[model samples]
Target: MNKPWSESWFDAYAPERFEAFTPSHVWAVLGLIVCALLLWLTRGVIRSHKSVSEGIRWFLMAVLFLSEVTLNIWYVTQRIWDAQTSLPLELCSVTLLLSILMLFFRSRWLYPIILFAGIGGALQAVLTPNLAYAFPHYRFIHFFVAHSGIILAALYMTWIEGLKPTWKSVGGAMLFLNGLALIVWIVDTALGANYMFLAGKPSTPSILDVLGAYPAYILAEEVIALLFFSLMMLLFEVLPGGRLYARSGTYKKTY
Candidate 1:
C-alpha cells in the first residue's frame, strides 16, 4: 500500500492535519533560532571579508529568486495556477521581491522597508505559517526557504553591511505598506482574491483569529504591524554595538 513519492509528496493538501505548535513546529522554531545564532556569529567574518560577503549576498538573492520561480512552476504543473491566488501579491511575496532588489542594488531608500517588512512579515510567516504542507514536501521546503531568505537578507544588510533605520524610516515603512495594502485591496475586490488576507481571514487558525472580525481586524493588523516595526527598531538599540554600527559610515557608499 506504499504510495509513490510524488503521491505522498503532494497528498492530503497538508500533513495529516497536525495541530499547531506540534513537534514539527517546535523543530521549525529551533531551526530559526539556529539560523539567527549562526548569522550573528558570522557577522564579523562577513564584515571582514568583503568579496566573500558579496558572494554570499548574491547567492542568497539567487536562491530567493529561483525559489519563487520554482513555486510558480510547481503551481502550473499541478494545474493550480490560478490568476487570483498565484500572483506575487501577498505581503511576503512582495517582501521577497523587495529583498532581492535590496540585495542587488543596495538601495538606501529600501533599507528600512526591507528591514521592517522582512522581520515583521517574514518572521511572522515562519512562526505561524499558513502552509498546509509538512517536512519533505516541496511546498514546505519552498515556504521556509522563501520566508527565511527575507529575514536573512534583512539581517545581512543591517549586521554586516551596517544599514541602519531611523524613526523616519519607520514612518516610511508604514506608509509604504499601507499604500501597497490599498492597491492590493482594490485588486482583491476586483478579482475576489484574498491576497494579503484582505478579503477575509484564512480558514486556518492564525494571529488573525484573535485580532477580531474581518474589516476591523484589518485595521488592528495595521496597528500591530506598526508596533512590530517599532520593536525591531528597539532591538537594534539593545544589541551590543548595534547603535555604533549604525552610526558608522563605512558602508554608506553601497546604500
Candidate 2:
C-alpha cells in the first residue's frame, strides 16, 4: 500500500541527517555555482543605465511570489488540490522567501541577480531526481512554474529595476538567517531531524567537514556567512548611489 502523507513526510525527513547530499544536493550546488557566475555577469548589466516600468515589475514579482507560496501551502495542508505522498521539500520556501525579501526593497539590477539565483535554484530542485522520490507533487509546482516564477521575478527586479545591496541590508540579512540556522540546529539536535542539515557531515564530505566537527562547523558557517554578507556589502560600496538615491544620498531606488 502507498504510505500516508503525514507518516511519509515524517519518515522521509525525521531521521538525523548525516552525509545528506542527494542528487538534489548536486543540482543545488551546481545551481549555486552557475548563479554565482550569473551574479557576476549581472553586475555589469546593473551598472549600466536602463529604463523600465515599475508597475509591471511589481505586478510580475507579486504574482510569482504569491503563486509559489500558495502552492507550497496547499501541498503542506494536503488540501488535495494536488496532494502528494510527502511534503518534504520545504527548502524552496526558505530560498524563495529570502529572494523575495531581496526584491521587496531593491528596484533595479538587484532584482535579476536575486531572480537568477531563485530561478536557477528552483530549477535545480525540479531537475534533481531526489525530488521525484520526495513526493508526487514535487513533479508539479516545486519543480517547474514555482521556481521559474521566482527566478523571473528576481531577474525582472534586478535587470529592469536595478537593485543594490547595502552593508546594513547585508548585515541584517546575515544576522537574521544565521540566528535562525542556529536555533534550527539546536532543535535538530534535540529532535534528531537535522531540519537544516546542521547536525553533522552532510550526505557528502563537504567543505563543512574540512572546517572540523560539530561546533567547529557551526563556527565556520558563521564566519563564512559573515564573509559572504560582507562581500555583498562591498558591492554597494563600489556602486554609485543609484541616480535616485544619489539626489537623496540614500542609495537611490527606481521603484
Candidate 3:
C-alpha cells in the first residue's frame, strides 16, 4: 500500500532520508541549472521591461516568504518546533530573508552582500543540503525552493538589474557575514542552540569536514570567506568588462 499524495506531502516525519549525490540529488541540481538557464535567457526581457521584472521580483519574494512560513507551520503542527533548531537563524535562512528584502526594496546596500554571501551560501546548501527529508516531501521542496530563491534573487539583481559589486563590496560582505555570525553565536549560547553551526559543525558531512576542528574551522572560514567573495567579484566584475563599465557609468550606483 502506498501513501496518498497529500499524506506524503504533509508528513512531517518523512521516513525517506536525503542522500548526497544520489539520482535525486542529480535531478535537483539539473533543476537548478535549468532555472538559471531560463533566467539567463530572459535577462534582456527582464532588464528592459520594468513590469515583467517587478512581477518576477514580487513572485520570488512571495515564494521565499512562503517557504519559510510553511516550514514553521509544519514544525509547529508536528510539535517539533524547537527554539534551538526551528528558528530561521541559519546562514542560508538569513540569506533567504536578505534575498527577499533585496528583491522587495531593491536596496543597493543589500545587493553586494546578497550577490556574494547570499549566492555562495545558498549554492553550498543546494549542493550538500543538510536536510532530513527526501524528494516529494514538503520540507524537501521547501528547502530547495528557499535556497534556490536566494541564489536566483542575487542573480536576477546582477544580471537583469545590472547591479555590479566592487572590490570594496567583497570586504563589506565579509564584514556583514562575520558580524551576523557573531550575533548568531551569542544567540546559540543563550538558547543552547547550534545555529549556523557556530557551536559545532553539522552532524552530517559538509565542507567544514575538511576545514579542521571546532574553533579552528571557524577561523578557516574567515580566510575562505575573503577568498570566496573576491573570486565572486572577479567573476561578476573583472571578467565582465568591469573597468570599462565603471568608466562608462554603466555600473552606476543604485542609491
TM-score of each: 0.90, 0.50, 0.93
Q: Could you tell me the TM-score of candidate 2?
A: 0.50
RMSD of 2: 8.3
Put down candidate 1 lDDT per residue, 1-255, tens digits, no spaces. Answer: 657777867654544543467787778778877887897798888788889889988988998999899998888877888879999999989989999999998877777888997678888887788977767677877887888888888888877777778666788899999999999999999998999999899877789989999899999999999999998877866777656644663235322
Q: Is candidate 2 or candidate 3 better by TM-score?
A: 3
lDDT of each: 0.82, 0.50, 0.84
Superposed by TM-score, candidate 1 places the C-alpha of residue 191 at a distance from the truth, in angstroms, of 0.5
For model 3, residues 167-235, the per-residue Cα lDDT tens digits are 777778999999999899999999999999999999876899999999899999889888888887667
Candidate with better lDDT, 2 vs 3: 3
Select the stronger candidate by TM-score from 1 and 2: 1
Q: Which candidate is the best by lDDT?
A: 3
Regions more than 4 Å wrong, model 2: 1-92, 98-155, 186-191, 204-209, 239-249
TM-score of 3: 0.93
In model 1, how large is the Cα lDDT of residue 213?
93
Give the lDDT of residue 231 in candidate 1: 88
Highest TM-score model number = 3
Question: Over the stretch 1-255, how does candidate 2's per-residue lDDT look in tens digits?
Answer: 666655654343333332225554455455645754664565555445343244544555576577666655655665443212223323455656555565566544333334333343454444442333332233332444456556556545544555544445545555555665777666666666555456565454445557787768768766765675565455545665533332343333444
Q: Report lDDT (Cα) of residue 186, candidate 1.
A: 96
Q: Each model's RMSD to truth, in Å?
A: 2.7, 8.3, 2.3
Instruction: Give the deviation of candidate 3 from the true structure as CA RMSD.
Output: 2.3
